[model samples]
Every structure is written in C-alpha cells, then in structure tokens.
Target chain A: MALKRYRHDWLYSFCSVFSMIAFMVPMLTVLGIKDGIVGTLTRRLLENPRNREISPIGTRAFRPEFFEALITHPDAEFLVPETREISATMNLIAEGYPSFDGDLYSSAPGDPLLSETLDPQALSHQLALGEIYVSQGVAEKLGLSEGSELTGRVGRRQGARNEYGRLPLKVMGVIPRHITPKYNVFCSLDLARMTEDFRSGYAVPELGWKGKEKGSEIPVYSRFRLYSRDLDGVERLRLHLLGLGVDTLTQAAQIKLVKDLDHSFTVVFLALFVVVGGGAFASAASGSIDQVVKMRRSLAVLALLGISKLRLLVFTMSQAALTGFLAALGAEALFLALAKTLNSYFGGSMGAVEEVCSLSAFKLVAAAAIIVVFMTAASGCAYTSLADIEPSEGMRDV
Target chain B: MDPSPQKTKNGAKEASPPDPDVSDDVILNCADLVKTRKGGVGYRLLVESMTIGRGEHLALIGDSGSGKSTLLDMIAMVLKPDSAGDFSFRPIGHAKWHDLWKIWRKGAYGIFEALRRSELGYIMQTGGLLPFLNVADNITLPADLKPGFPKAEKRERFKALTATLGISHLLGKLPSAISVGERQRCAIARALIHAPSLVLADEPTASLDPPTADRVFELLLDLCRDSALVVSTHEQNRVLTGRFKVWRIDCRPGGEGQPIEARVAPLKDRAPAAALPAGRVSLAKSLSDSVH
Candidate 1:
C-alpha cells in the first residue's frame, strides 16, 4: 500500500526525490575532492625512500654497540656505522676520465636506498673487501661498468713526508640516478674503516700498505646511516633521537603539511554535511506532514476497515524510506558522473597516477544509510496526525 | 396490549414492547443508550429499548437533524455513547455474548475492531471508497483484511459478486471515473465481501436520483438478506414496502439552554395504510405532534 500510494502521487514523489538529490550531490562531491587531494599527497610522501631517512646533522661518536641497540629500536629499519667524513672521501682514477674526488659511505644488506636495485641477501653476500658500488654521476664520468678496475688512493702526511697508499677497486654495479644523484661511492664497512685507519697512519697488513702499528683500542664511529620503516616511523625515531641529545634531519614539515590539509578538509566536509542534511531533513518532514494531511480521509477509511495504528505508521515510514533510498541512489549516480568528468578535466595536471575527485565505496554506502534513516525519522513526526484521525471522520466529512 | 404509545406525566410517550418472534432471534439488544451533544442548543438522543434480529432488515426513518445518523454512528461504534445500559451483542454460532459498554470501559479496542471487521460492515453516504484504489480493489478490501482468507476463494466471490451487481466491466476504473450509482454499488460489494454478520449503512442512496436510488437500494437489500441490517435513510416511500420493520425517531424542541430530546420507537399497525404517514422530511415532526 505504501508503494502504491507513492506511485499514485508520482509528481510529488519525483519532486521530493529531486530535492533530496540536490542537497546530497554537492556535499558528496566536496568530500570526494577533499579525499582525492589528501590521498594523493599522502601517497606521494610515502612512496619516496629519502623521506624515511633520518641522519644526524653533525659528527658524533657512536660505538658499535650504539649501532646495535639503535637497530633494535621499534621505529628503526636499517643502520650502518660510518667513519669520519674527511677519511671517507676517496680519489678515483679510471682509464678514460680524470681523477675525480667522491664522498664514500659504508653500506650493508637491507639498505633502504638500494632496496629496489639489488636484493638485500644478494647484496650482503656481494659486499667483499675490494668491491664497490658507484653513483650514477661517478659511473657516467669515469666510464665505469661492472667488473671494471679502478684505483682508490688514501694518503696521509706523517711529520714531513707525504705517503700514499692505493687499493684496486672493482665496480660491483651502478646505483640508479634517481636514488643518489651526487658523486657518491658505497663500500663495505670493513673496507671503509680500513681506509680511515690507513688515513690515520695506523693500518699496515690488510692492504700491504705501510703504516704505523696500532695498540689495542676500542673502535668508535664518527657517524651512522639510519633509516626508519616508514614516514611516520621517521618522525617518531627523530623525536627519540632528539631526546637523546642528537639532532637529526628528516622530512617532517612535508608530512605535517599533508596531515593539516587532511584535517581541515574533514572539518569543512562535516560542516557542509550538517547544514545541507538539516535542510533536507526539514523539507522532508514538511513533505511528510503535507502528504499525511492530504490523505487523512483515505487513512481514516483504512482505520474504519480495522487497520491497526502500528500498521499505518509502518506504511507511512516505509514510504518515506523508499523515497529516500531512491534519492540516494540518484545522488550517487550523479556524483559518479560528476567525479568522472572532474577527474578527466583536472587529472592531467596531477599526472597519470592521481585523480582530482575520488571517494570510497564504504563512505557512499554509509551516507545512503544515513539518508534513509533520516527520512524515516522525519516521517515519524506525522504519526501524531494519524493517531488523531478517527474513523468517524470518514463518516462525517466528504 | 394495544402496543401503542402511552402518555407519561411529563407529556412524553413510552416505548412499546418488542415482537415475540424477533425476541428469540435477537443479534443486538440495546436499552437506555443515550448520547448528548452540547452547544447553544444542546441535543440528546435516547433509545429506550431496541433489538435487531439475525437476517432481519430494519429501517430508521427521520427528518434532518433528527439524530438518525448519530444513532447509526453510535451503533457502528464510531461514536462512543455517553452512557449505555444493557447493550449486548451475540453473533450467530458465538456462545459468548459481548458487553459493548464493558468493552469500551476496559479499553479493549482490539476486540471491538476484530468484531467489527469480522461481523460488521458499513456503507457511508458518499460511497467512501479509497480514491487511490480502483473499484475492484475497493470492493475486495474487506476480504483482504481478514487473515487466512483464501485468495482463490476471494477471487471467485469477487467475480461472482461484481457480475451479479452488473459492475464487472467497471472493475478497473477508479471511483472518480465511475458514476455515482456505480460507486454506491461498489460500496455495497465492499460491505458484503466478507459476508459479515451485520451491516450498517447511513443514507446509502441519499445522493442518487430516484431510478438509480431504487436500483442501488434494491441491490443492497438483495445482497444483505443473510446479514442483520440496520440502515438509516429518509426515503419513506421505499420503507413503506413490507420487507423492512420500520422504526421512527421523534424529537421535541427544548427550552433555551436545554437539550432537545429524541426517542427511537417502532411503528405500530404496519398492515394498515393510514397508520404511518409518508412525507418528505416531516415524518419525525408529524409523529411527535401526533403522539403529543
């Protein structure tokens, strides 16, 4: 009966549904666009390995145990001890290119910078004493390739005489240009420490280069290479390091920007939803009252025929819910169409991977459910009018 | 023993006794049922004693504002009487009789509504068919309300009933599209669809012309032969026929701020032509003046 009555008054039903859709579409569109922008920015921020790196700003003495304990931290992903920056530099000589100076760093398995290019386990096995990996700039300038041999010179001035020791280096592979664009070379920690010791005039046997013999002393590193598992982990580890009186560099500002934008968009969306949803509710309630008043005689006849009051209430609410559901469906369709058009028109500027407007299926379903419930509650206001109607009214009034 | 009106001390007439044959077959019995309406001129309707027997047709004849419709509404349970005395109903095959006044006082509306749906039907003067439903749906509405009624049986009855009333062709049309006489026929069909134990119709043919009124009224009478019927109408010529037991309401104007009194009593001497006068709207006035 509810369905029949709704269908009988098709014009009124159409107008009611159209009005609801008018309020719903703009709110949904705004929510979708906000989600799109925030989602794209967060995705881009998380995709880069550089944002996850947390390196100390200046040289600090860190023992081997310090590296071990730091690696076990909850936010720590990977760590490798490094020598002093002065000793870490190497002068390279290749067959065709002139002597080029490059900054060298110690590396190990599971380094986040090399995760995509080389398998961690394979890299762990391949990090031999003489093997080294060069950055794209170094590889391009020196005309170096895998299995190519080069000379790495480590020199020191003892009192008056300048002494130099050279080691033969094999190019293991070249890191991608985008990963590390500077002239940098990567070697095993043992090899890098040996160079430092040689430069300090304390190594003699490992490379057969002449140097002073050192007494037994505990080893310490000037710096360390540290990385976190993700962007949020980077910020957490940085804060922990700051608490330990270590200042670190990380991309926290960019992350904060994206988060603030997300929060602001959510606030705006909620405000708009409240205002528009309230208006729609008021309109729907008025429509329900008018319809109830208009059909009082027919309802009274139903009462005269012994239809229960509960059943009459059910009929009224069911009709409202059905109309609301149809309106929500229409609104969703319109939103999808509009989103497609908006994405196509503006997505070109955001590149191939990101859209200008997008929403999740879960949110759309939740919104539709809310609309139906609101409409049902609005119709409940008319139940008082229904209860006041007496079956004698049908007999008396035309 | 003459079964005539008897003069009382206040110049009012007392009611006569019920027929012995109908006393045994009584379906509805009422006594001292009074309803009062207060206004600038207050009005009160009083029924001293009345009985409606099973399968018996009764007509209430009165002028306008003579409390005819009010009495029907009260009997139909749409309007609650201010006070009732000995108002009881017993349907056929039901061993327990229902006390109408007790049911109202106890707030047991469900029981009353059940009885109304199962045993009583009503026809309003305007042929109150729902505007949204077509004639066929309107006629079959009462049967639909009865739970566990077989659909196929209802369909068969619907076919036979509409065919009998000569409205089978107009079944698909709405009430607005149908003629006034046709809508009245559909109302009759709706009232009798469940084959209730009693039917109450208030001025069923008041809005129709003479020829159409005769046809619609005859259809109502023919269809309701098995159910006890209490119809209120102003058509005195039709009531003069011998098929119905006639009752008349006589009202007397009261003084200022006093309630005008109306009484329900059966007419005596139905066999004689001169006993009951036939007029347009003066039946109640003539009866009141003649009795006084």
Candidate 2:
C-alpha cells in the first residue's frame, strides 16, 4: 500500500523529506553548542587557582573582631596579629625600567629585576620587602624587564598616618599583562603598612618587648577587602568585624553578582533558541498535518477496501519521516551556507580559520531521531483518526 | 419442461410435512419490518411492514423523500430499524440460513461478509464501482476478496455475463473512464457475480437515458430469474406485471396515527395477452411488460 501511494505522489514524499531536515539540523546544533560551552566554562573555572581560595583577601582587615576572636577561637590557622592601611591608586612609571613594568605587581616576593633600572646602591631604594609587583601599563611605559628596578613613591591615601610619611621604595617585579587591571599594581602588605598615611597616629610601638612610638592619631576609611575560606562565612564574620571599627566587602556579594549575570544570559539564550527553532518546526509540522487531513477521503476509501489501520498508520508515518528527513537535510544545508558566509565575514577574528560548520556524527544521529519521532507522532495521530472514519460517511460527502 | 415440472412436484410430495429443511424456492422473508430516520425536525417513519418473496421482483414506487431508498437500504441490510421487527431468510444453503441473520443484525458488515454469504447484493443509485478498479476487477471484486470458487470458473462466469450485457469490450477500462450506462451494466454484473439469493437495487437506472434505463431494467429482470429482487424507483411505467409484486409506499397521514403505509399488490396477470413474436418486443413495451 505504501509503495503504491508513494509511486503516485512524489510531491508528498518530497515534502516529508524536507520537513524532517528542517526540524533536525537547528535542534542538534543548538544542543551541541550549548553542551560544549557549558562543559568548557565549567572545566576552566574548576581548574583555576582562585576557585580553591577560601577568600582572596587576608582575614585581618575583613573583620578585625572576628580575626581576634578566631585567633583565640581554635579554628584559626595562622594567628600572627598585625595591622595595615589599605589604599588604591593609579600610577605611571618610565617605560624602560625593568622593575617599573606593570608585570611587577603580579610576581611573588623573590622575583628578580634589572638592577640598571633601579638605584641599587641604596637599600631603601631597592625593591620593597614582601612581594612588590607593578601594573602591566606601568611596565610597558617603563620598558621594564623581569630584573628591572626603579623608584616607587607612596601615592595619596584617604586615611592619615604620621609614622613614615610620603616615602619612596625600590621598584619591584613587573606584573604579567594577563592579570586584570583592577589588581594591576600589587604591593607587599609590609609596603602598604610602612607608608605613613597607613598608620593610626599616636602610633604605638610595633608588637614585641620594645618598639618605636609614633603618634596618637587614628585614621578612618570606609572600604576594605575581606578574605576567607568560606565566602558567606566571612560575610557573617564581617558584621562582627564592623563592631571592631573596620568596614569590608564580602565574597558573597561578588558571587551573587556573578551568578545573576550567568543565569540571565542562560535564560536569554534558551528563549531565543525556542522562539526561532521551535516555531519553525511547529509551522512545518502543521502544514504537513493539514496535507494529511486533505487526503483523508482517499485514505478512507483505502480503509474500506481492506487496508488495516496499522498499515495505514505506517504509511502515514513514512510520509512524516520523509518530510522530517528532507527538512533536516535542508536545515543542515542552510546552516552550512550560513556558516560559510560567517566564516568569510569574520574568519580573521579566529586567527587562521578553517571550515566554520562543524557537523558531529553524534549530533546528527540525535537530531535525526528527534525529527523522526516528532513528525511521525504528529502525523500518526492524525492518520489514526482519519483511518477510523467509516467509508459510508465518506461516500455521503460525494 | 414437462418432465422437470413432474420431477419438482414429485420432490415436493416426497418431502415430509412440517419440514425443517428450507425450500429452494423461498429465499427472503421480512415480517413486520419498520424503519425510522432522524432529521433536524424530528423522526420520520420511512418504511412500515414491508415483505418480499423469492425469485419475485418488487418495484417500490414513491415520490421524493417517500422512503423508497430507505426501504431498499433496510432490505439490503445496510440500515437497521431503531426497533426492528422479525426479519428471517433462508439463503442458498442451510449453513447460510443462520449466517444471513448475523449479517442482518450488524446493519453494516464488511463487504467481504456479503460476498461470503451470497445472500444479498446491491446496485447503488450512483453505480458504486471502486474508481481504481477496471470493469473486470469491479465485477470480480467479491470473488477476489473471498475466493469461494475456482479462479477459472469465476473468470468464465464473468466473461459470459459481460458478453451477455454487451460490455465485454469495456472489461479492461476503469469505471470512471466508461459511460454511465456501461457503469450501470458493470454494477449489475458485480451484484450478480456471486449469484446472491436476493438482490436489492436502489435507483439502479437513475442515471441512464430512457432507452438505457429500459435496457438496464430488462437486464435486472433477467438476472432476477434465479434470485429475489427489490428495486426502488419512481417511474410509473417501469413496474413489472405478472412477474413482480408491486408495493407503493405513501407518506401521508392515515388513521390511528400511522404516518406511513406500504400498499402491496400482485402485478396484474397480463402474461397470456402479451404473447409476441420472438425478438420483436418493442423496448418500451418490453420495459413496461417486465415492470408492470
């Protein structure tokens, strides 16, 4: 029966093939790309060193009272009590100095630099103790190399201190260009502590038996970075530190902002895919079902002549499968064409690009199955209803 | 013919009184049949208390919507009364006597069942031959669906029948490609292929020209020689005399709340007066003579 019908209606057969192709190609492409992107992003995030950190900032400035409590609270890891002034500034240095490069800020404490770029004769003019890394922009301007040295001057501070006011230090290692601009200049904790503007005046002696006394004035600042193993745990700790006269930003706040952005983008991408691909498949299926309904009378005659319902169903399913297969093929061709056009337009962006259209065997098979199921199910239901119609009723129409 | 009559009488004499065996002559029996149709306005009684006998031709004459077709459908087992009275039939064989009742109860059984029973046939008003099938296939459709007889035998019968109808040349053409008269002939061929005990035709000559309609009716009467025939028609002159039992259905108000009534009467006995030379009967005279 199917053979007989197919031999007579080539147009219907071709339509079936075309509908399948249209339904499958885009569905597969979208599924594959989404899976690939999510997998790649997750892997990159998990492998990064920052993902392991409990908190990126030191605990002391985050919540002073919590830090004090933690020092005696048994769960604390390192209990060396210390205080420092934190500040942010943008600086520029001569381009040729090796130690003056922007990369100096990202390096560890022992990184080497060019002595010729710095005043090596004076210890106070050497690289500051603890790690001192300069910003990438400053490194480029200073023409800094790994071993370069240069003069480092304290910049403006919001809080006042009288201990070591407005002093200069030796240039340090240049930070790598890959580091983000926000953390471009990374000075040692000791260096930030030494600057007079960082000290709370009426400065007392440094912790120990005997130390120098500076002044009695205290500085007030509104912002600080809090670091902890548990991001939310540290925020809870932050409130305690606030009672100790320190203000801080918790990792929880930063995480919330990042999550919101990620969720918003994911939803937008999915909505766009559904609106375009879903609508196209639906329209194609609708047209195919209408054609099937139009052929109901002929099918009814066939049913009366002794074709079983199951065989008729299979015939109808074959029609849908053919349409879906063709549609999938057409969709693939369209995707390929678009890929070619895109590659021609923006191939240079990817640096030595080849073919842009990537057809994976797995994706193709999955899409084909989906197309077949969708088309077959839609047309099968319609065919079943039509097949059950009595031939007497059909003749009445005549 | 005299010896055959003596043998038939002798056979009837030998049969026991109150015989359970069905007589070969009695084919169809409808006792107190009734039919009703539901329209937008209300229910309309189409047929009431209609009965037909074996090898007997019946022409149901009535006006439009007067239930002629509905009566044919009821007798053809295509429609069942809303509340049926008793309908019984002794088909060609004893085994088929019970099967006919089963087929009648279903109202619309598969066409194969009718072919299997060989108890009833129908020539639809519009000549219902499947468009895809050629004249030959249309005539041989019943045998093809249910191969009860040998292929060669069936083929021989089909050839002979088509030749008698002068449509042998059209055997290879589809029904759609043929003229309406040829199509009607083919429909008659199809209905007679199995040699059913009863043939019910609904307006079999409706689409034919007057001459063609007369020829078609003659063919129907010829075929009715071995089977009972009930045809629905509105033509007054086509009623068969002496050979058929005429029944006219009237859809008018009657006494005691009866809205429809069937007036059955034996065809007038004009056979002796209609003796004519061989092959010399005028077409109109022959039609009127066969259908009075």
Candidate 3:
C-alpha cells in the first residue's frame, strides 16, 4: 500500500551525469589509442605499393652476381637496373613542363630510374640482348617518339671505354610521364656492365679486343636489387646477404629507417594510452562515488520499505554501467572531433587521420574496462551506505 | 464487592452471585504492575497495578511525563517490561482466532503482536499514514498485507468504514494532500477496520480541534463498543466527562509508595447513570448473549 515515490532527485541526476563523464573518459581514451594504431597500420598496408616504389633516399648500385642472387630470394619478385642523375626534363605534350626546348637524354627505358615504361619482362630480355630502352623524359626532351635515334655522351663512365666514345643508340620506346618526369631513365644492365672503370666491374680493356671478340667476349654483368616482404624480414635478409660476402649498405640503411619509425610509434602509443586511460578511469570513479552518495537517502528509504540490500546494490551497478557506456560514447565523439580538427589544421591527409580515429577491438576492450571500474567503485560506495542504514533509524525523521 | 457473578438462562441479567468456591469468569487479569524509569539518580514507578476487563472501556489520563504514553506502549507490546516487573494476561478462547487472523492477514508479524491482534488498535498522537499512499490505501494497509479475506468482503468492510467516517470523498487523496482532521479520521478508520477487541489511543485527539476531537472520540467509542478501549491522554475535560470508566495516574508520592506511583481508581459513581447509550446498549446486549 505504501508506494515508493518515483520522482528523480536533482542531486542524483547531477551525480549520475558526472559519473558517466568519468567512466567515459578512460573508455574514449583507450578507444582513441586503439583506433589510431589500427588506423595507421591499415593505411600503411593500403598505401604500401605506392610507398615501396619511392626509396626514402637516393639509389645505390649493385653487382650483377648480387642481382642474380637477390632475384632468387623467396620474397624478391623481380630485378631492374636504375641509374640516378639530376636533370630538368619533362613531357612537353603533357603540359607541366614548358621551358625546355631541347631534347633530353637520361636513363634507359625499363630502368628503375624511369618511373614508367620500366617493364620487368622487357628489361630482362633487353639486358640479355645488350640493348637499352630510353626513358620517356629523354624522348619528351628530344621530341622523339618510340624507336627514335639519339646520341649522348656517358659522363663519369666508371668502366673501360670504347673507341670513338660518345655512344649513339636507338630508343626502344617512350615510357609514360606519370612515373617520373625529372631525371627519369631506364637502361640495360649492359650499359653499366660495359663501363669497366666502375668499381664493381672491368674496364673497356677488360671487354677485350672490341672488334676481335663477339658479344660473347663482352661479359654480361648482372645488377642485383633486394626487396623484402616486411621490414623485419628485410633486416634478416640483409644480415644473411652481408654474411654471404654480398654488399648491402643501401638495404641496411632502409631497414634502419623503418625500425626507427616503428620505435617512435611505440612511444607515441604508450603515451596516449596512459593519458587517455588514466583520465577515463578517474572521471568514472569520481562520478560513481558522487552518485552513490547522492542516492544514499533514497537507498535507505527503499531498504526500510522491504527492498533487499542486494537488489539495491544491483540497481546501483546497473545505473553505473549505463552511465559509463553513455559517457564513453560521448568521449569518443569528442575525441573524433578533436582528431579531425587537428588533421585539418595540420593539412595532413584525411586517410591517416581517419585511420587513427577509427574504433577497433582494442577500443572496445578499453571501454569495457572503464565500465567495470566504474561499477566496482559504485558498488563499493553503495555497500558502505547500505551498511549505515538501520531500519528503525530510517523510520525516524532524519 | 464480590467480583464473581452468574449469568441467567436468557443471559440478559446477572442471575445470581457465584458460589465462593467456583472461579473462572475473568479472562484477562493484571496484578501489581510496576514500571520504573531512571529519574536523575533514583528510579520512579510509572504505572502500578493497572487492570482491565474483557469488554470494558478504561480511560487513562495524566499530565505530560506522567507515564501515560509509556503505560500504553507497554500494554500494546511495543515495549518490553523491565525484568524486575511482572505482567500477564489470560487470553480468551476467541483470542486464538485473533492470533491466527493477525498472522494470516499480516503475512509478516507486526512489531506490536498483542496490539496487532487481541482486536487491539492504536491511534497515535499524530496520524502516521505513509505519505505516498492515498487515504483509502492507508486504511486498508493491514488487510492488504494479509491474505484469506475475500475481495467482496474486504470491499464491503472498506465501504462501510469510509461512509461511517465521512471520509469517502477523501479516499483517493494522498495523506499529505488531506487536512489534519481528515488524516486523523483516516487513522481512526484504519484502526477500527478489523473491528479490534481492544483499542489503545495515545493522545488521539491531541492535535484535533475541540469539536473534531469530540466527534473523533464519539466515533472511536461507537466503533469499539464490543471491545475494550484504553486511551492515555493529558486532556482532563475529555476523559472526566466521558461515560467510560476513568483511571488517573498521579505521580505524587502516597502512603507506602514512591514519588511516581500511579493510583488508578474509578471515577465518581453516579446514581441512575444515563441508561446505556444507544450504540452501547445494543453492543452490550449482543455481547451478553454471546457470553451466556
């Protein structure tokens, strides 16, 4: 007959809101960190193909034997020759470059130096045939189409030289301009192989009696470039190659850069986790405590009215869980907004920012932990308050 | 005067005096009841040797702190008697029915077991209705707590009491929404709903206006006609003028007693006392017939 009043107390409402915020902070923080890590990893995975083509630094030369061995490694797909030189050359037809009027000669077609038209199959056959493919940049500069003839002197030729020296050659084909417009070229391995003065090879004299010997007398030198499946694999493969008396300075350097980036990511993740997780836990705990205290009188009244002590405890816990969940959502939204604003201000690509802000399994785990912590804290407070309420005392005017 | 008397065949008159050897009519008895309280350094007796019959109205009156409330609480079973004192009662055969009904009706035992049964009801100085429950719910609280009563019967009882107390209009209002007089009326209605055999009222009319208090007292007496009524009060005029037998607890020290002893004596006997009042006569006749 004595019904309980169902009116909401302002103090309790305020406390509940506070508790929710507290619980949410940690959950959101953890979620943010998890999202950021997973996002970065996913973006890296998605962009890996594009990123792999551009070496962080400049190119390094390798020996014919090294190339042969590297191509045989399990993860290595193909080997291509790349010659590096700085020059201003452009696709006059494509409209980005207008100043250059004269033709340009850089690297050969099918070379890594030429971003486009460096076909693996074509380059491998050409290396076998001792022919070179001219870069698109060279064709564009010279205003020459495919199969055009061109002449250029090889400066700083490291190997032996032939008589009547500035070599004349026929351009096999023009590469597309999107790969690289500046200093772009692809050449057969024979070009570098023929230069005997180069540290890793024999000179023109070593090519031996140029007219007397056929193409067989001119040794076909191979260049090796190593590619790895993963950065760790790269390091292990580099070590193995170095142990095998092969040169790997460039490969080792690239692996070192990747390792450094990984270490930096670790430090950043740790810092974020501590800050966010701690903040969320503190917020949830404070809010839960306040709520329990605020509802003490109501709890006492209910207890006297024949509601069991255990039921009250469960009720409070349920309230805490609900509040924690809501608060986590709010905090996550805020974090996302902040991440977006930061990304915009810094002019960073949205892909990376979005990846970092994405929620994942780790974020869910963090949110759950926050809820558990809040419920535990709330139950503790409820227990203390419940212990203090005596039925006779409750019936009296407070 | 000889206390034992025999009933006639019709049971309408006291037929003849009982033989001195035969003794059994008295169903409830109390002897040399002494209640004490710590006063400064010494203890004081609050009530001494108070007794009542099966169907008598005994009005207890005193000034504040005179232990009237304490005595009522003792009789109501709300408080335990001190180890040094003794109190006892011989329950009648129908008392078992009251006990069974109290347990069956109230699923859980009320703190005041004896007062809850024995057809005993209490009206406090201030009406204690649960604030959230309406007047009707407050009145039916006891019956609702128990089982075994048919719905129709309960409804009939509820309707009769509400109409008799002139509170039918206020049945739906919460206790807080009603006036003090109405709240008191509701409390009285609740106490009489079960037709208790004994009603203990502690300053039931203390907060009511004189007219309201008189009306409440009259209603209380009418409803409790077949039961014993004990009211502890500070109001001298209300008790002195009432038709019920009166007991005044005087705290003044007397012969062979402490300073706080209670001396209970009958009010001055009047010759040709007003014939049994309308409600009382019928109630007495029915009770007399039942006893015989």
Which scores higher on TM-score, 2 or 3? 2
TM-score of chain B of 1: 0.85
Q: Model 2, A163-189: lDDT tens per residue?
A: 223323344555443333433555543
Residues B181-209 of candidate 3: C-alpha lDDT, one tens digit per residue: 88888988776665555667778888889
Model 1 local distance difference test score: 0.82
Off by over 4 Å in 2: A1-373, A380-391, A394-398, B1-28, B38-59, B88-122, B129-178, B182-200, B215-230, B236-247, B255-258, B262-292
Candidate lDDT scores, in order, read 0.82, 0.53, 0.51
Q: Candidate 2, B197: how far from true, in Å?
A: 6.5
Candidate number of the best DockQ: 1
Instruction: Please give the lDDT score at residue A344 for candidate 3.
Output: 59
- In model 1 chain A, where is the ten-residue run with the lowest total lDDT? A117-126
Off by over 4 Å in 1: A49-248, B1-29, B86-92, B96-100, B253-257, B269-291
Taking the tens digit of each residue's C-alpha lDDT, what string does model 1 give over A225-331?
78888778988899888998889988888888888999999889888877887888888998998888998988887877777777888888898998889989999
Instruction: Answer with 1 or 2, whichever has the higher TM-score.
Output: 1
lDDT tens per residue, model 2, B1-292 = 2244643443343332323443556555543355554443332443334445567888876555666666665555545544433445666554443323234444445543444235566676667776656788778865554446568867887887898888999998877789999988988887777677778777787778989998999888987777789887766466544545777654433335443333333334334423422322343343344344
Candidate 1, B12-115: lDDT as tens digits = 21123333444556778777888899985788899999988888899998777788989887777677776666566777656566777657655677876777
lDDT (Cα, 0-100) at B272 in candidate 2: 40
Window of ten residues with lowest summed lDDT in model 3 chain B: B6-15
